[model samples]
Target chain A: MSAARHDGPGTGGDAPTPAPHTDDQPAVPGTGEWRRLSPRTLLVHCGWLGAPLGSLALTALATGGRITAGAWITLAAIAAAFAVVTAAGLVRWARTDFRVTAESLDVRSGLLTRRLRSVPLHRIRTVDLTASPLHRLLGVTVLRAGTAGSGEGSGELSLEALPVVEGERLRGELLARAAAEAVAEDPVLARINWRWLRYAPLTFWVVGGVFVAGGSAYRALHEMGIEPWKLGFVRRAFEEFGNGMLWLTLPAALLAVIALGSVGALVLYVENWWSYRLEWADAGTLRVHRGLLTTRSVTIERARLRGVVLREPLLLRAGGGATVRAVAGGLGNKEENRKRSGLLPPAPRREAVRVAGGTLRTPFPDPEVTGRQIDGDRHLVRHPRAALRRRRTRGLLFAVLPVSALLAGLGAAFTPVLLHAAWIYAVLATPAVLWLARDAYRNLGHQIVGEHLVVRAGTFSRDTLVLRREAVAAWTFTTSPFTRRAGLVTLTAAVAAGEEGYRVPDLAQGAAAGFAATAAPGILDEFLTRPVGHGDRTPST
Target chain B: MSEHAAPLLRPPRHRVDPRARAWWRVQALLTLSGPMLLTALVMAALSVLFFPGALPWLGPLLLVVLVLPAVAYLVVMPRMRYAVHAWELGERAVYAAGGWFWQKRRIAPLSRVQTVDTVRGPIQRRYGLATVTVTTASTAGDIKIAGLSDADAEALSRRIGEVAQDVPGDAA
Candidate 1:
């Protein structure tokens, strides 16, 4: 634990480093290792300054051949520079590069400076290959690897102008690696994934549409010499009419919500349609691909998966399956450059387990699976009693909305005009705070699985988080005087990407050992002697 | 889901002190700003709520909550700032934390760290401070601690460079 080195959870076999490419990658004649040269096609495909170049070309064309030769010369120079730079970059990259023999890959690249990047055959978060309309015309794709931060984030590795076959071949190899990796652990390939094909994109579309609609509405109103939104609370006529006409308002409000919601949802749905595909199942990893026009394919290693979270809207609780995802490093949704893939939303819980045989979907972004079998009760799921307290508090807080309305109406009729609804929220807040305190005090049980630390809470919608000490990137604890005296501390443990990290609020002091065990087992805590308050200086690990 | 199963993952045994110049520049504001803010706020509160008569007590309290910490930083940092700490471990992670009074800390696992940047400001040259910013998935709040000597900053960066290349599964 002191200044010790931690070994990687092994992938067995000859999965170490790939053989360095021969001094020269043997060249083939037709469609050789490098694609044929065409700067016209390359400019349109590169994406860096495509638009500007296109605009310049249009301008030159409008001026005819007088400036055409000069334009062509300039264009050729820029294009040549792009090609030379790319070729130089490729040469440098290729010089230091080595690709794994298997699919779910490992491509290490670095020149005078070097790097070795690995994507588990079964732990690939997401792989996206795209093309602008122009790129499509040139038959090239930009392949990006994002360990999903909502599948947001520039790619870790990208191959440009690769023959689709080669790119697709790479993807296939990775998928095969994933499958092979999956087979090594699980005996199930339960791939029944229900893509909320319409949900996200619909949501995106509807929201975008609503924004456009609202802007259009505003423009239309403005053009017509009127203010649309300034209708000022309900119309005076409606306000005066009161409850008698409330029925009419009800329909209108419902209609507005539906119309806006629908248009927004549909617009969103169209923007990103769910192309959720369950590629392969076996091993400890699950391959799930989901996204819209920009598709994201992800692989979650069973060993790295954190835990299972079953979230339910009060209405959807019954036998309905749930949307599930895995927690692994650099894979969540997009937003961070470190993310290698997208967050995999797999099959609903029941079907997923049934499909994957008996594998339960862990809640945490990625759950770690010990190569050894689950020791049953030794890792029984547990919850603290305080979980119920939070639920109860939430239940009581739910009653406040109507109560506030009632208080507002009653106050307006009898109290000072300044005695407003604001006070009611404050009043309600007090109860909520008390409930929170009660909930915090009662929270208890936590379980220690093989190499994972799973914490559970909630009486209804349960939340179970599995932490993999091996994969935990960072850990910190913050304490106030009162909490310190109470022997409690809040831990902020990051799982590579902070987006899907864990914030354990108010755990007993002794749990630091357990938390540490889960965060970085065997790893000694460096901050004990070191005052870890230095703000914002990136660490080198 | 106990993390205990991963055997022992050498818990955060890495640290990388960024450039001293940037570190020092930000250290003053980060450490002193609180007290300065606390002082302004507390004084304002007293003026508004306690009335002018309570200035004596309010003034002392402000000194305790605000000036004391800042003064402590200025006094102790001459030596401690030079004691910049940076450690890089196993792979894919880096950490740097420093400051004399109100201490500063930052941790970035290479996987989540989007960018490794060194920022030099005019104030840094004046006071010998520099900052190394590690962007991550955490949003604007991702600016980790900053403040260090120029050499230490580069060294921390080089160490990160080594570890980023060292992570077992780094082959992309």
Candidate 2:
């Protein structure tokens, strides 16, 4: 694939750029633009600010106890203690000093013992900035960065409230520079593969939809009086449903459930799609930004990519898709977002595809190769054409088929009341599964490029993984009792630090052996000679 | 020792990790431990209310529930640990060894390290212990080695800082 690199010199892709901040002024211990957010802004996102204190007052009134009394005093003491903490937090805003300068990123704040941390600009992997609803309201964003670590990490942070556009620009700049630096260091392994993002939203949508459905069901039942808040009512409803009257009642109930379920799914689906974008500024640099109600952006450098991972669940495998992440460059204000209930909500699939594709210039070449599989994003492809014997078991459409079968069996058995919504659901599920099957069949491709392997899978919502032979950070071999019995093993490769990712899956035994021999021929030979623990067990992959 | 053991002679697993659920849970606890300890203590207090003399009996139990678990966690598990067969790997990462109850091992490749912090708490200081926290971008969970001496922790922190300069992962 012909590619135009944005940061390559003389390629006219913003190749030469000055440092973001120049040392025009002396940024000493006290003087810097890196000031903490005001307490007013923090309070906007502080969930405990109001209700917690109100509850304490409520108990104070309900107990009919004087503040000076023993139990009341204990409660009051706790209240006072918490109040002091709140006051402390309110005061904390003043003392916090987050500095952004030409050289380093620094945060100096802690109640008892101050913490003064500084990360050089050059070492930065990615810097992520995020804004939650409250944060957006207050015009403040958090800056999170990735640094290398032993186990956890020694990350860099600058949590200063800034405007949305400014945050994005800053994030974009950092990401670009980080990537450029990464390429400068090792162009051979300077591969920026974002193919995993394509499949990320699908899982997000399905899981979010399920939760919305379940939560809506709970709410509707509670509201309907069929299942009241009172345990007695719930018990009665369950009892009634288990018996004769359920046939008639279930149809109505199922109708209401389906209605609520669709609404909830719709809300989650739309919510996840808002403001989602990720940019691989360059090789080692990446930027993740998204949100509708709240916008967030974070940038990471290549040096910070701890490992690369590829993940394929049974569902994704059926669809021949995978999700890859570059771990945690502190989630680009994810903590604060979570605090505001604005966690990694789903982004629109179109948005995901656009940004994911933009960052990834190529796709994997081969559709399927059965061998020692990498976990997370890398593909251990299993193609239908290679099968000497092919069998289409119920596994692909297990959920839909089983439900449909049960609907045919139990729906027929119990006068068809239970089949109402469940039947419709089964019907809907079958089509969805079939679509997924077709998508999976079409999305298969993989290739080994000059020792830098690029594996692409998924027909629609395709996921492409680029693995630089040089940048294979770590590899782990896992075998279980079941895997041993089946002559299979799972090999996990970790890449791009921060993202909790690994490419792992079960491989046919011969494939595993062959994979071990050929994948970095020298590495496997070393492993064979090395006294690596011989594990013999079949794993439940 | 067998020649096969050369590259395999890694440092012990980090005292502070399990990249899966164990890591997630411990991370959840560690991040919130200082504030949440009171809630656990309150629950423990309620449990002991069964007997008037139960207060004394419950102290150890509370320690077990509240403090010891955290300590044990600080003594076991890790996403990775680092040791060297030679110096080609550089000082970017270091080797940390811990865990006995259930043997765990790891290798913290310095390139993946996000940040290095020396953390000290009241209990930690009282016991003359400090922790070396290593953040990484590759793994969501941060790996840490706790209970080192203040000097050791500082030295480790410095070593990590220096090494990370030379060999950060792809981002560097």
Candidate 3:
């Protein structure tokens, strides 16, 4: 909680600070002075070692009344294992040391064979700080630095269990040169609006959480050698619930699950995003700091950002809200991609767009251009009718027909009831499929706006991605036999950020090539030529 | 609407080395034959040892189902692939067009090329052929031009590597 800064002695002068002496070990052998992790790390490390040993002891107690010889041997073995693990951890903690120099961050760690890694300050694009609940209690944090152009794990330098103030100072010093012009001025872009809590339950997490909870509960009971269905109260409730009205029970159960799921989702949302703040930090970096129990502070350089994506799922869109995510490089690996990319939680559509524009330092066009002033249709170029036909045929062949055939086959093999039901199901599903195909067609649109190319697509969850034209590194054109017959091709723009490739599927072939050439000129210029009478600057729309 | 009816543009002109055709055929044989031959041999042995009655019909059926596809893969598909696979190094970018059934044409900006690797498998080594892969920062930026003569692969890699170095301000 203290905001005190601990500037390393190396930062003030070239003289190396004397290494701290442990009980028996000598000074670390190196030119640059090596600094050890805070002593608090041992406690954190011991907690990690204690979990499995505690579990084993509990299991032994549950399985037997008194200590047998075998149990005594097991206890001794557990103790030996614990001691070995603790000693190994202590050695590892002792061995790991980091030195911050003017040019690079050097970290040396290993037990027997030492490994040294040096990361240049200029290449460092992100400096992330995280603290778990226990870490917070100990006033220590984990620091990670990511360099551009490095592969996934190799690109990162992590310093685990540093004093919170020291970690903050290190982060600032590493980022100081990169953000030379930046002053410690705070400009709050967005902060947690508790009203946004309503959008939490609107996500698919509710349904997914319910299913996951049910599955885990069943597994837990089964693991304890008890059948879930044999529980007296559960069986009595199910019997009483189902006996009265068979049809109504299904909807009732669904409602109950949904209510429970919504509560779970709300709790998760609060825990993950408590006190969330999006701020413009020193030197053109966007910093997102949030969390309840385990806090995270992620800083992304604005220069690495390629674009922004505005996501509107079905329910959220109906409620006129959307979420925003950044497309940036050197943030983190794939596992952390979602958390690092998230810009804004679901909020009002206008507010989300405003924040996105503020983040990108550009005017992000609202895709929902419904009024008379702007002819949104003129700006967007939709796929040909063939795309719709293709979607309908695909739905029939891949989805509806397969289910109908299976139902009919079962009916033929077993009973006539299913065969009659199949006919009714197919008839009812045909219109729904057609509607989905039509909606999907409506969702497909691509347009070039000023310095950015906006591609809008998706059926249930509509995404409108506004990508900077200069950020696109390559263009790929794909055509299949069926797509070729329909005179269509898919054009994808490859960028170094979110999704990696943004594709516009089933565009008219010539238009796709022309669009590609226009979007990123030099890459596709060799393959494309202007048609006989067409002007060079003619807009496809 | 009129533009939609425009004729398709001619494919990139440059092709891989002429010897690449033979190399591909050998590669196809090595890759497809091993698995198919193993499966056939296993089934034949099982039938002969355990179910002698099935051996008469099973042996020929196995040959037809497994060996025929391997033959087609080793003989027919490689030739079709040779006709389809082509690459061109442009001044600003590198282009690769490949795949017999589902054709893919990819272009990677020369400035974006982060690393260039020339790989030679055992069978490819026998044919004096290699595959050159150009990688960029993006996950989808791996553009592979397979079935190049070893010398050609090395030369191409060197040339691209030099170009990538010469081009400045590639943020990555």
Q: RMSD per prediction, one decimal?
A: 13.2, 14.3, 7.0
Residue lDDT tens for model 2, A78-177: 6786677667766676667665566766778887788889877565654556666677677656655655432233454655554443444345444433
The CAPRI quality class of candidate 1 comes to incorrect
Query: What tens digits encode model 1's per-residue C-alpha lDDT throughout A1-541?
Result: 1111112232233212211223332121221112222233344435565644765655556556345566677688778977886776555534433343333344445566666565544345545555445565565455555453333433355545343334444444444434243244344333323454333322233445566777886775554334554576537656665656788877876677667767566544443335545533445455554445544344455544544333322212333434433445445343432233323232244543343223334323223222233445244322333334544454556665556666677777788552476466758666775665454333333545555656544323334455554555555555544454556555566554324556665555545545554446433343332223323444453
A480-524: candidate 3 lDDT, tens digit per residue: 889989888888888777667788888888677767766666766
Candidate ranking (DockQ, best to worst): 3, 1, 2
Interface RMSD of 1: 9.1
lDDT of 1 by residue, B1-172 (tens): 2433322112233343334534453566566755586666867686868598877777777778777767666545644654444443334455544444333334545544555677767767665555677655444224353555677667766765565555543221
Number of the predicted model whose lDDT against the real structure is largest: 3
lDDT at residue A41 of model 2 (Cα atoms)? 43
DockQ of each two-chain model: 0.12, 0.08, 0.35
**Rank ordering of all candidates by lDDT, starting from the highest:** 3, 1, 2
What lDDT score is found at residue B156 in candidate 1?
A: 62
lDDT per residue as tens, model 2, B12-39: 3222311222343345466755435766
Task: Write down the worst ten-residue block by lDDT for model 1 chain A.
Answer: A1-10
In candidate 3, how many Å is residue A329 off?
Answer: 0.2
